[model samples]
Target chain A: MNRKTLHVVFNSLFGIGGFCNAILFPIVLETQPDSLAQLLKAPVNFLRQRLWWLWPASFLLAALAKFADKKICDRWGHDAVKEMLEILREKGFPGNKEPVHFHRVTLFKHKRWWLCWRFWPWSGWLVPVVRSGHTTLNHQTCFLAPDEADHAEGIAGRCWSTKAVILIPTEDSNMTLPLLNPEVNAKPHDPHAMAEIYAKETFMDTDWVLKKLPHSRSFLGIPVVVQGQPWGVIVVDSRATKIQCAKGILASYEEIARPFIKCLERLS
Target chain B: MTTAPWIQVEPSLRMRSEPRQGLQLTLFVPPHEVPQAVRGEFDKQLKKFVIEIRYLDDEDFKRETMDDTVCLRIGKNSRRLLGIELDTANLNVAQVQFQLKEVEEEIKRAVTKFLQKDQAQEERENYALAIKAIESKGEQLLNRSILAPAL
Candidate 1:
């Protein structure tokens, strides 16, 4: 279970345990030999002798309860994301022609190089926990997959850092040599060299998203927040760049993310 | 055919696809900006490297390049510009290629600014910076590089 859920369960147990002991203290004192020392001594002896098993039992029950809640919330949270993606689909991801995928990306520390004995050394990735599209890879596997953007890399990471919506093709490339231009044949020059140069110029700087489906031109990443801290981002991608690049469209995508905040807090 | 022994001397040349020390090399951002992605890729296929640019001017930047070496400057007025340069002493010009996507984007931005309603003065200058980024870089690449006389 995540820290927030564990915190709530522990706090509840503490409150209940304290309240019960406080109320029962005076009643128990009246029944016992009437002294502060006697009151403390009686329960200690009784608990040690008769109810020793309850302490371990209570802890076992709390862990089991947390395990169950995690399953239920994970299902519920994914369903919420699926629903939001449907809404985004109907809206055509604000403005685009082809399929636009929506994914719930969360940050988690995973093991790095298990061969080395130093432990998973401070590696974190913003991975897709749940996704909306023609789902191919299992969500759980994607969690451990290397393709997930490192917290310090990719469009998802940038959104988490900037705390603002990021739209790609952020600026223009200014060089236009025939050698650099793909259309203008830099023939007599090597074909391999020509393609590499064009690709360098074409590859977008803002996105580090993996398995980027072809024709997915525009990328929109919104920071998915939980418990007042930035948790991850919801990535939305589409084929059209111009329409999806507007402010109104970006704001609309941000609105879609609001409904799922509750679900995020509960599951992860 | 019988070869002359005196003409049999082999050329000692080591060529590498120039690593893009271009805008793609910034540690804070991803490559296509820095050629680390392209750097790891060099061993995979025997492809030419993105030319590395060493700008003659540290600030604002006067830039130069040649046929064997291609140099193009990248970035906005306030941002640090990355220039492209190639090593041509070894590899035939058969392999070198220059990246142009940023140049295309700049052109698009310039056109957009030209069409916008609020741009007679400052926008005109903004439009010009975008154009000059394309023009000067293109002009540098267009003119063939002149090497100084080897004494």
Candidate 2:
């Protein structure tokens, strides 16, 4: 049967079962009283006497199930994201004209309980790096690759929270490969603008990159901080016409990145 | 159109034009050079086309020193090339020549396809505003599909 129908049937069965156990079963226990019956009846009477107890137990069981599901999902999601990273590295940053690398991965915890439980019950992730840092860290380090460094700087200034999460999108295999690369090309039509846009909206000025290039058609760069400290980054590269990085894909990546950052935090 | 120096050799390609996202183009090249007649014939048959290109290298390309290597970007999404990877280790004259020809062909075909993609016209306007929004603030709207609650 269809999903909706199945849900309706299952829920109906549960409601009926619960009602029978709560109401009818007690009545049956009261009416059928034999020596053997009282033995079976004794437990039912005890439960009936404490009718309110069933309510809390049911609620607790449902809560436990949900908690269990979340834990499982988190573990699986973490493994999946890690596997994806490995695959991207193994593929050698496909499609990009430049070479790219991943420096570090991080996970962040959502402070608001409701928000955390609703979206990320565990935590968030981020990858931070010095996009254009040379031998010694200098403000002029910003000038070498003005566009990328500027963007990286922007992220560093505002979104510098050690607790914030970074998300990456892996569903679109096409975008995933390039996003994982460290180096990218600049085409007039590249999605640097879109990446910049996403960064601006999602991260604070301290935590995102804010630069653009004329020739860069598409580019990939990772955050440069983990748990509030400056870390490395991940990168992607590609050169297909008509490519645009969507907001949805990046958000998905963030989901996985959060937990990863948490794991890193624990290790450190 | 016929008089234009650049010819439309293949069908056009189109894509969503987001400022943060860009188009990618890949081209296939022959291993060896052919006669002028062959080049002319090939151009006539398939001079333009479009393909989705993702940038993979964001760091290495930025630090690339060799002009022959064409280190275009420094992001994780960067890859070597679309169809066939050039053997950079060998550094043979013939290989370089072949790769150069391929790059040129890819660019031409990509540009033609880009122009044909009419959606870019509108997207460019939207992306411009998005850039402005980002300039005002550091964050932009991220896709919700993949977003889960932060831990």
Q: Candidate 2, residues A76-100: lDDT per residue as tens digits?
A: 4445445544443334333444433
User: By TM-score, how accurate is candidate 2?
Assistant: 0.26
Candidate 2 lDDT (Cα, 0 to 1) = 0.30
Tell me how far the alpha carbon of residue A255 in candidate 2 is from the true structure, in angstroms, after superposition: 20
Error of 1 at A63 (Å): 2.2
| Model 2 / residue B35 / CA error / Å | 35
- Candidate 1 residue-wise lDDT, A1-268, digit = tens: 7646765776676555554445443354344433448647767556545434655555565565556556653466677766765565555443434434432222222223222221232344445655665555343322221323333444455555544445444323233322322344345565455444433433322121222313344455555444334466655554443223333333344445445555656555
Q: Give the least accurate 10-residue stretch of model 2 chain A, judged by summed lDDT.
A: A137-146
In model 1, which regions exceed 4 Å deviation?
A1-54, A93-121, A134-151, A170-215, A224-229, A239-248, A254-258, B1-151
TM-score of every candidate: 0.37, 0.26
lDDT of 2 by residue, B43-127 (tens): 1222311111111111122222223322222112221222111123322324212333444443344333433443443322222
